[model samples]
Target: MDLQTFMKDRKKLVEDALFSYMNAVKAPEVLLESMNYSLKAGGKRLRPLLVLATLKSFGKSEELGMPVACAVEMIHTYSLVHDDLPSMDDDDFRRGKPTNHKVFGEAMAILAGDALLTHSFEVMEDLLNYDVKPIKVVTLMKELAKAAGPTGMVGGQVADMEGEGAQLSLQDLEYIHRNKTGKLLGYSIVAGAILGDATEEQISKLEQFADHLGLAFQIRDDILDIEGDAAKIGKPVGSDTLNEKVTYPSLLTMNGAKEKLEYHIKEAKRILEEIPLESDLLGQLCDLIAKRDH
Candidate 1:
């Protein structure tokens, strides 16, 4: 199981579960179509992959974590759907296709995103059907809510919107991304650790690992905005500059940003080394995030 093969296998598994879960939802044809449209739109299923990968690292069955993995992905997709609306980032494309609002209209797109967000909890509750302990499921539900809610992604989004056209410090930029992007990513790993029955100490270390990994992920994204190919990234390059948002490269030059990315990758992998588990895949994932074109 090499890293690429492992990722391909897990991505397929997550995709199958996503469609299966979406098919089970009973809604108006238009709304359901809108929801499934974005849900099926192609992207690296990184958040869900993290869940399954963490479970595997702890010697747990990936099947047991499948529902949680899918649920997190749903939340992630919902956020993207909303993020593309006219009131938000106002992007016309995602994953190399017209965004949800573009294809479905703004009203339906909003409803579709709402459906995914609420439905994610229902999907997460399905973990009990796999005989996951009620307590663990309940705990995960709480954590997921916090991660996706105001204190997490939503809070980060609001801060980002407010910071637009304004000069932002690196600390402020970190605050925005740490909550906006990092919280959900951190949740992906933490969910697996909980279900995999990690010790408190190990969970703490993994959280630290997730923190560094999340920052590295965002920094690379900023780098890609300037240097990456639009075709591979699935969006126009220089969106950050076009939107007038401050980025790592803007705050600390391109070279400085790359150095910062390297620092976080080293720290993330260092934290992984201290955790007693089969974490080679996670280390590879860190490298992938650093070098990913999309």
Candidate 2:
């Protein structure tokens, strides 16, 4: 299938899996709603789609990696919910609607983030009931934990909080984006490779590709904050400037930031070419990240 058709089809698949899995939560109604609110908030299912695309590139069925896709997305949604709390970025809107903390009370929003984080494991555990090996399931859990825990996304959040009102170098900024966003993106690619039983060399190439892709993704986000439309982006622009957060555009001029973004995309595509697999979708995704207006 073509790239657009492939993404459209896989998006539906991921959405169905997310809704089905989330709706199965047996918790209190309000908390469940808060959790579901962000899950259904309609951001691009980029991480999950990466999982599926990597699986497909390695000649594995997307269904085999569906559980991992759902698990990663839940972790991502939980992070977004927590990141929007009053003590955090203090955003009142997400995906063009009220944030979880805005619609639900702050307490419920906290619980909802907690619930999503915890329940992602339950969703992952269901893999054991399928045809997957016990060792593979264990490896997946380890990967997810390391990426979302103190050593990864949470650690990045702490660094981000501390960096506010402080002058940060480009290296310091890269460190934050690499951990906060890149770790999960890398894991999604590696998850598909593991599921498809890719060779060690193949996994390494994909990991390198993911690293560059993640950096490019963040740089584009910085650019969008300056040049993008709120309607397309689904949030008011200039938030980074408003919050006094250091960003690529703030340090590098807009032209310089675009140059950096192009460099990353070029490096990512070069690494992708060395992967020795069908990665048209991954290639298209790289272009999308560099050019996305939102």
Top candidate on TM-score is: 1
Question: Taking the tens digit of each residue's C-alpha lDDT, what string does model 2 give over 1-294?
Answer: 466688788899999999999877788888888888989996888899989999988888789888889999999999999999998988898887899999998999999999889888888887886688999999899989998999989998889899999999999999899999999999999999989888989888888999999999999999999999989999889989998999999999899999999999999999988877765888888998999987
Please give the range of 10 consecutive residues that has the lowest summed lDDT in model 2. 1-10
The global C-alpha lDDT for each of the candidates, from Candidate 1 onward, is: 0.93, 0.90
- Error (Å) of candidate 1 at residue 207 is 0.7
Candidate 2 TM-score, true structure as reference: 0.97
Model 2, CA-based lDDT = 0.90
**After superposition, candidate 2 runs with Cα above 4 Å error:** none
Superposed model 1: Cα runs more than 4 Å off? none
TM-score (C-alpha) between model 1 and the true structure: 0.98
Error of 2 at 255 (Å): 1.3
